[model samples]
Target: MNKKTIGRVVKYLKPYIPLIIISLMAAAATTLLSLYVPILAGKAIDLIIAPGIVDLDGISKILIRMIMVILLAALFQWIMNVINNHITYRVVKDIRKKAFDHIQSLPLSYLDTKQYGDFVSRIIADIDQFSDGLLMGFSQFFTGLVMIIGTLCFMFTLNITITLVVVLLTPLSLFVAAFIAKKTYNLFVKQSEKRALLTGMVEEMVGNEKVVQAFSYEDDAIERFDKINDELADVSLKATFFSSLINPSTRFINNLVYAAVGIVGAVFVLKGRITVGQLTCFLSYANQYTKPFNEISGVVTELQNALACAGRVFELIDEEPETPDKENAVVLKDVKGSVMLKDVNFSYVPDKKLIQNLNLLVKPGMRVAIVGPTGCGKSTVINLLMRFYDVNSGSIQVEGNDVRDITRKSLRDNYGMVLQETWLKAASIKENIAYGREATDEEIIAAAKATHAHSFIKRLPNGYDTVLGEDGGSLSQGQKQLLCITRVMLSVPPMLILDEATSSIDTRTELRVQRAFAKLMAGRTSFIVAHRLSTIMEADMILVMKDGNIIEQGNHESLMKLGGFYSDLFNSQYKNV
Candidate 1:
């Protein structure tokens, strides 16, 4: 609806502007040449029928001219269409690329706040709608407008009084189109948005299928899906109803105008105000004007649908992301990897603190381990360390520099992290292990060997060239963890964090992984978030957290000597393992 945004969308056509212009010119030539056929028809009737005499030579020349023009125009139009369609498709590809790239630059909070289905729907389906509008609107609608205008002028020249009356029906056609199109656009927009939610639910359900089956909530999931599907059905029904009415209603109004013009032309001929040939010419032009009117009306409805999609797509691009640092923000550099958390209270939502009045520090190269009950802010330390979310009170510092003052990329680049769930994409083992780092295959193999993954990788049919399934389904959990650790090793960050990396593996695998973890932790500041206390028994420092507060801290032996929370947790938590 906004012209400026429309202009921005049109700017996408800049690269193809010359081709588009040729297409428009071809449309004009076709329309104008085709108009001559009627003129030839009128002349043939006047000379051969009205005069009761035939001049074959003059008639043949007119016939040949019409045929040649028709052939040439058709060929030109066909070529233009071929060229224009290719360009339009390319423009669509570019739009998709830009939208996705911008979406990535947005904060992780953006993904959390928006529905996954809705976001994807905008990029895929919604962008398609806009692409259709741009392609067809430029190629057809503009040319149709020129045809309508040119044909109207020719009609007026043939017979002024009749032309005046025929032009009157145009407003009626416009009114019908405007009213129906407005309503249909609104419906389609709402339908697209709601459909996104339904699609999103489908995606979420499928992704979490394991959780659904494990919890025996299959029936509940089905019921929720049914509700969304039902809503989708209802909205689609209404949207189609409105959209379908567009053509029929517009056509009906146009037919009424066509009928009125035909009747009026006959009356004019009877009154002797116009010749029979001229009356026929006026009749032909009436059809000419109305044909494009119908086309423009149809384009109007199509444009509405495209605009509906535009609205959705624009809404996503316009979303205000979580604020990153300003352009002038400092890059925290040359760190010895000392970390400080001073009186830091945190929450995912208001009035619900996850960590409260927390304070801690770890000197460079110390292995600091955090142990707690399931929800006692153990992983929150890593979150705080990474600055995924800012603290509600107090500040986190890296080597005396406030984390908030540094750019997020710069701060995060200084650390390497391995989480409890090691996510792997579908890629070659070498690429997956090296990931985004600029590491040579030699470096990558070295890192893999360090994490005990190189031997298993080499045993595969393709070795480093073997492709992984989604989330590395082909590999065991411990193997996946080892590869993930190898990936972090390639990054070689100054600080390291392992969040329950070995917690879920088998005892034998855990022991092997523990050795690898120990190797990775040497000569770097490390934070280990663990529930299984045995894994952290060798930690240089242990912090016992209960309900968001650090209740005890010391080396494992000293904490056991104190017989406090750490001792109680160490004795109780890992009994099964």
Candidate 2:
């Protein structure tokens, strides 16, 4: 485990300092009281049992004191546990929240490249293990140290010679513990990494179960899962086996110390150097001292595991987030939706250029259509316009203002978008349409009717109130597309982006959707990314893109008159349909 990672974990406790202090004090008091009770018991024997004659009054008083001390010890122990739980879980909550917020702030590109299940494991399983281990390790570690030191002080007062023997033998247990811990630390780290990998595998396979069954790849999928599962089991077993040896090894050394104390105490008693009562007290303190060593050894293993988990959590927290907006950045107002790209260049990777020297000037309220084959940088233009990614060279401007100079939120707020891949939350159809904004029921119904969705929605058991499953599972592809289109219609932004927005709807439904879009786009700038030639035949301007550059531009008549790539593309699709 890295020291920096452990330090980061400890920093989370700063907010709960008062609770931590109380817990520590309670732990100390609990250990001290429990240690003192054994001494009280020994004195009772000297006063009431081991004496030449017993005194009933003295015996009764001593018994009462012992019971009171026991009760206090129990009370303190309960307090320590309760406070430890509160502090640990509170820290866990903060860490999880921080991780989640960081995820929200990360760049879309970052989320695109990482595995989804790894994030799930870190937020849920890893954090849970870290908190549980820290709760046990911290409480036991502090109390164990206090008990060991307090017991040693009492032991020295009774028999200096015998105490020296215990001190000499104590290092054996510590040495054994340190050796075992050193050997198991790397194994625990490896085990944690493997567990995360295994979790990601399970998530990916389960999420794609339909695809697997359709292709009859069940045997292959099972083989891959079994391979990872077996590796996880093997690493876990090794780590557990090594950690399990720590307690017994320490226990063995502590037992030897216990035996030597007995021998030395007998020598002292026979030589008349100490009373039998003092011998009994020293022996009890000796047990208390050695027991902490054993307990602390167990805590060492847990602490190491906790640190391993903490390291993973800290790694996620340390990731650099998307660059912040410039200080006092410009906020667009009353956007006219004029967009331009001047000598722009971009690529998902640096070595492979996808878009170079791309230029366009679009007027407000113009219906523009961008058409291209696969991998021709069609959607890449939309990504740059939205600032989901920035152009590597040159500039993209909205209303003649460079997009880079504007706050992302303010720039994106002017445009409403519906993509080929539609998304809906697990909520009622009405709530999903409204999303976070307020909408009148009449307005929602009007939007649905415009997209030819009102009839199907009303036929459902609860109309707009029916709750959706994940990704709106109850709806067909066309129905889901209609809902998404309805969302964009309700927003009614100054600009629109429809990427295959009506491709899933039936021909009859597509006509209604296109009519609704025509009404919505009457006075607003609209960019339509479409494959069907019929959808964009009425566009005010058509950009025929190939290899990231616009090779031809004009309306349908002028482009077909050129008899170029656009003409071929239009004729091919027109014939195919």
Over 4 Å off, model 2? 47-53
Clashes of each: 0, 0
**Global lDDT of each candidate:** 0.81, 0.88
- Shift in Å, residue 313, candidate 2: 1.5
- Compose the digit string of candidate 2's lDDT tens values, residues 332-391: 999888999999999998999899899999999999999989889889998888999989
Per the 3 Å backbone cut-off, how many clashing residue pairs does candidate 1 have? 0
Against the true structure, what is every candidate's RMSD?
2.6, 2.0
TM-score of 2: 0.95
lDDT of 2 at 277: 75
Tens-place lDDT per residue, model 1, 1-577, is: 4455566667777887887778777777767776767777776555665455687777888788878878986886687678768877888888788778778777665676778888788899888887888678766787778788778767766777777887787788778777877678767777788778887888888877889899999999999989888887887788778767767877787788778888888888898877777767777887887888777877776777777787777677777766769778788778678998998988777877789888888899899999888889888778878978778889999988888888988898989999988899998898898785877889998888777778889999999999999889668878888888889978888899999877657787678778877877787899988877788889899988988899998999999999988777777866666
Worst lDDT window (10 residues) for model 1? 43-52
